[model samples]
Target: MRPQLRLLCDSSFRGPQRSRDVASILREVDELQAKEIVLVAQDLASYGKDRPDELGAGSIVDLVRQVSAKVPRTRLLYLYPSDLSDALIEAILDSGVPYFDLSLQHVSKPHLRRMRRWGDGERFLRRIADIRARAAQATFRSNFIVGYPGETEDDHDQLLSFVGEASLDWCGFFEYSPEEGTYALGLPDQVPVGLMHERIAELREMQDAITAAKRDELIDQTLEVLVDEPGIARSHHEAPQIDGIIRVPLTLPTGSFASVQIVDAQGPDLVAQGADSAS
Candidate 1:
């Protein structure tokens, strides 16, 4: 049996037809008996924003509640967008899933403006703190683009500072790539490719250390993890495929949930022993 099933419901999941479409899909998957159902979307919080659902479930919070009620047996998860409003953040917290995959390109306000995004470093930090305050075990992941057009030394420093302060569970730093017909292509002061590489390397190193430190904190803690395969599993703190995985005994069955105690931290990944074997 497959460990989990992922449904890619992008921006197309909108308008009055959304409810019927979702119902149909859920009905079809009900027989699969998958361990987890991950609803992958660009901005799940923005669901039904432009067009309200015909059934009166007009927000992501409503959608999640509906799905949970329908699929009470399977675990549900979704991806988050970068531009999260206060209402959306509250909705996410209420859903009882503390994992956040914020697609924030950059935290520097000036740089974000250049990228046509929102939120500054300070604002992002405050929001993150609020989430943690509400859910101590909450996990956060975000991506940043290094060396955007007109990116200054101060902007890069601000990003570094934010990474240290935020202490996100997962982070991805990519060098800026110019695409055809994009606004960045016409922008002046494009950073050199070599400098972009250097900047990304710095970000990667700093974030790697932070991620390792955070994972180390989980050592000895008993967690209920879902085994994806014979030797790989993950708790809510780690997303499937994208984030680090937990190494379990080969005897563990795939697509099964087991209680494990984290035994060691291997940088980003972790080593865990079954609760029965843990000392």
Candidate 2:
């Protein structure tokens, strides 16, 4: 009824010095009466992998199991270090949280390397395949930055190809803005401002078509939606604010869950109704 709770998973939330007390955090969740949660692993796999013996695959597996057993309704906001280990992928699938919001900056490998990001477009597609094989209805979402320094025709084409191939259900493409003293500003072959706009426009058009097609596939499917506000509900596929929502006729209590039959998908948002009744 109240939507979800975004509880910090640990004290050093942004970086490596982890401190997560599962039971204590669950108590806070109960105090808040939150039915859903989002674990913000800003870049867990990256640092966690550095010392496998101490924070290895085993620890990740155990962590997933702990959270799944304790706070079963939580969703992970990210799975970073783009090339996910098999253990992490299996842990995620087993965790029952089917939504993924990857920080995949760009698809072009050269472009990605330039941006100081990990993973490439092809590897990401393979990861998607692996995830979808187990969780067919998984919602894949990601954000991309377009027109980085030194971006060329080939790089743009590579990203456009990824937009079509990634099968992302929801995505956002942002135009690159030069931040003062950022390393990106020092790179050569800076794209012209007008050309930068052109690249963003292309990515947008490509993703719109892909997102629309994917949403259309959800018609008539029964999904569990949490009523966050009056006449507004969100399924597992939908996140807060930035993502799409479901419009419902039922005046269900905010912060409660309901079984909804997806009636329509207009653009990114959806319209839903009670499974057994009309809207």
Worst-scoring 10-residue span by lDDT in model 2:
5-14
Clashes of 2: 5
Angstrom error of the Cα, residue 131, model 1: value is 0.6
lDDT values, one for every candidate: 0.73, 0.73
Give the Cα error of residue 81 in candidate 2, in Å.
4.3
Report the lDDT tens digits of candidate 2 across residue range 85-112: 6777677677656787788888888888
Q: Which RMSD values do the candidates have, in order? A: 4.0, 3.5
Which regions of candidate 2 are displaced past 4 Å? 5-24, 46-61, 81-83, 274-279
Off by over 4 Å in 1: 1-8, 11-20, 28-31, 53-58, 70-96, 274-279
Candidate 1 accuracy as TM-score: 0.85
> Number of clashes in model 1?
0
